[model samples]
Target: MVKSPVPVFLFITAEAVALLANSAFLVVFPWLVLSHTGDAGKTSLMTALVTIPTAVATLLGGRVIDRIGRKPSSVLAGLGCAVAAAGFGVVSGLGALNIGTLIALGMLAQAFLPPSTTARDALMDAIASVGGISLERLAGIRQVVFSLTYAIGPALAGLLLTAISPIAAFWIIAGAWTFAALLTTGLPSGTSRKVSEAAITPSGSVWKLLRSRRAVWMAVVIGFGASVITQPITSVLLPAHFRDLHQPQLYGVSVSAFGVGAILGALLYAAVGAKAGVKLYVGGVLVTTAGIVAFALLPSFWILALGLALGGLGSGLLAPMLLVAVTRNTADNERGQALGVYNAASLGASPIGLGLLSLLLQRHPDLHAGAFAVLGVWALAAVYALTRPSVIVSTPGQQQAADTAAV
Candidate 1:
């Protein structure tokens, strides 16, 4: 009912909050469950349960965004996430929580998050169309925000965990999600000037799109492989290795180094991406792969820091590039769905990859560095996938199809 700024900053704030709520609690919640249950399996399940529903909900969320508009779907998702977090807080205080209860609540919380995120992606795309900004520029802006969130959110979560109770962390996350809901309420109506009206000729349906989008599938594979490399460094290698060296504090420093590098990389992308074009994506992947290799081989803390930063920067470039690329093949009408599939694959693969990495660490501790090499291979595969004829933005038929689909 109320008017808002044309190029409003609310979406930015909403996006940052969404990232904070989704990621900050990731470090907080597992520990909360472990403190209560003292069961490793329970803790693991608590951690894994959220991803399943979130991934499933993401696909549906895309269609919902297309049908209902981005703002409304996002607001609904934000509200759901806030309410779930609030429920966890209430249950924790009342001593009514158990593993089953926590998992159920966590599932509900995550299911809402992907919908909110998909809507945000759609809204950003729509805004870029209205502003006459290129997709790369929009992606650069998104990269900056994501980088900042990854940099700040974990530190804030850790500080909250140490200074107060983990319950306080949940409250903080709830407040963030609630703020996203409020921000979404203020966004103006659609400014999409040229969404094509052609019916999505169900070319194989949603399942077909999921199957045929080689870039999307490659994105998932490469993302999962990268996560396998990174998660172990965060969870196992850093802490254990640093503890052995009697420099546990370096563990935190190393993690911070990765975050700072990501922020810097995203900033760099924001500055040069529109002009850099495909070079940005190509260079980023190579830098990232090299960084991962260096991280594994270099035992010194300083070198490790540099490697992590380089890799983070590389990771930062892909998001925006991939977003733009995904949208190129998608019709304006189906932008939400296409982006959802791309975003979902990117989000969905990490847990599976990380889980397998954890298993490898347990079974073949010597293969730890091998994990990084695997990521490099995957990145090369992703590069190859991006080069396929169907993925090239220069293809007229695909471009025409994309233009028609968005309406």
Candidate 2:
């Protein structure tokens, strides 16, 4: 152990804020756009607003994280988000908020957000290596933080919708992240050493990993499929569903159950996922699909919430395992770049999903039908994934040996 819990705690808090910002995308941000413009097109466009730039930025930003150092990247990320949030507040107050401004600011925030968060991921991995924390424990803690934020962030954003103006909530987002930046007020008090060129670049390290490591490749593929399934639902369908019902709060609250279920799932993973095999992984994906089916087939409030929670449980099981797979497959010096690549491909699918969903929402009167169609797409993608050989996960010593194996 590195002799301090402060860095780990600080890192977790910063990550929580980032996840909260994402949950905001799935909640208040959509409401802000729709409430202002009353346009589903604009609201659906919000998904692209967040994802496209994030996908592109993360792809490029992964190498940037290695080049610039982790702490600086993180600080920059927090500041970017702060500006975006504060900008929203300022524009709304000035009566100047418009789609153009929203798009520009959203791009700026997302462009910075993922790389910085990835940097933090690298930073924490380093801390764990040096801090006496096992990678499994570290991954578990991070997954828990993610799950908790997903659980609470939407609920909080929704509550804000009910209790506060979107503008005020914007300021609160700004203030929270500003505090995040101050923390340089820092993780492990800063471990942003520059990675050597060889470490940073290996003809796109993540792609190489995908080619060589079945586990990493499978994680990215499953992650991409999951991303494709989720974006439209979280960013478009559910929000639209609840707002139309004039029960917008349910959107956030129901999503919260997904997060809650994630916590349970993550805990279970911590308990046993490390040793679990392909069958368990397949089960998780199926469970996740079942949750989406609930949306396609059921519209009752409590049922939606329960189904989402069930989905969360499934997701929770897979998430930490994904992290472990990626980390186990990469060395410390190359972790950020590799993760960036993993994230880029995985998250890149999100914009595609959103774009297609946007078109569907525009053409279709029934959102549930749109959801059913999404489920069909997911089924095909899952088939593609399930057909691939299950990843041959191994113990750390064996994994490290495999990591350095020739492609």
Candidate 3:
């Protein structure tokens, strides 16, 4: 039997909407904290407080996805996100939003986000299998969509925050997730065909196979590093920078610039990624690291934008590069587990970094000093990626990434 294209497209659309909503919500939430309290330390602390649940969820949510089917998991995740977001919006609308309530509601809303993301990835894999679609091609397309969300999502949130109240802006997040849940219900539903074997639970042989693949192992670290550094940029520092300026819209524009740069980087990966060898990935990381560093050094408007754009470009390349590296190295049976570890490393690392940066920035009175420190850390991470080994020799297309980079 032939599968219809509708489900695949519908799945993509649902993910796009859901992601856009989540991105907008994240931007709005931090700003809300900063604006209301007029304190950068509290904002950083609150952001870290909210991030804790998401990191924890990413670590442990695989079993839930396994038990309940990715499709149902996605649907439930959307609903949970919507309900949590709505609760926050309701409280804010009532003029009762406070730091304690914000953290509680933010944590509630954030906890669902990782599961929602994981379910979507698993769902897309299942969809590709059923539809005879290319997972690589689909993943590339989704990466573009993801980048677009950051672009429009923050800008839109900024607009709403400017024109309407944050309460109204936040309500839109709830509505978008609700819409995403409804859209997910239309897609095909089934449990993951692959088993759930997390690193901790993996047998000795599986663990050995994973570690033996040094390139992919290091690739996960690179991704984890990328995420860890980027979080402070998005969550703590940038917001503080804008809070000082007293301009919410520029904050959105700055983040949207990162998103736009990410779009280009993702597109670059799509164009030349199949053959993107170790050298090209390292080059991109170094170049993007400079951009982030520039962002920290120069706080002026246009220069700041340029720095973030460069940082954004690096994000685009690093994320997909990690995905391709993992998919190329692992077998079908091992892919699920490897991906779980990758997600944990990539997404889970952020909370720790965010929390640490929050502490550093909170203690330091000057945001610029703290910001430079964060960028310096990211620069070190980029240097670390340069030192790592390439993918396994047996893996296909290792030369292609290199060849393309050379071109």
Candidate with best TM-score: 1
lDDT of 2 by residue, 187-294 (tens): 654466677776666655466656776666767777787778777877788888898899988887887787788888888776666566666677777887788788
Better model by TM-score: candidate 2 vs candidate 3: 2
Tens-place lDDT digits, model 1, residues 1-407 = 33334544667777888898888878877878888889989788778866679877887777776776677888888999989888888998899888777888888988888888887777776666655666567667777888778778787888888887877778888898898888778766663222333543243376566456555444545555555456656776668767867998888888887777777777777677667765666777788877777677746889878887788777777666666666655555676777677667767665655666677667677654544545555666556745642443233365455434643
Q: What are the root-mean-square deviations of the candidates from the true structure over C-alphas? A: 4.3, 4.3, 6.0
- Give residue 205's lDDT in candidate 2 (0 to 100): 49
Q: What are the TM-scores, per candidate, against the unseen true structure?
A: 0.84, 0.78, 0.73
Ranking by TM-score: 1, 2, 3
Q: How close is candidate 1 to the true structure, as a TM-score?
A: 0.84
Q: List candidate 3 segments past 4 Å from native.
A: 1-4, 27-48, 88-104, 129-133, 161-171, 189-216, 234-257, 275-283, 289-307, 328-337, 354-376, 387-389, 392-407
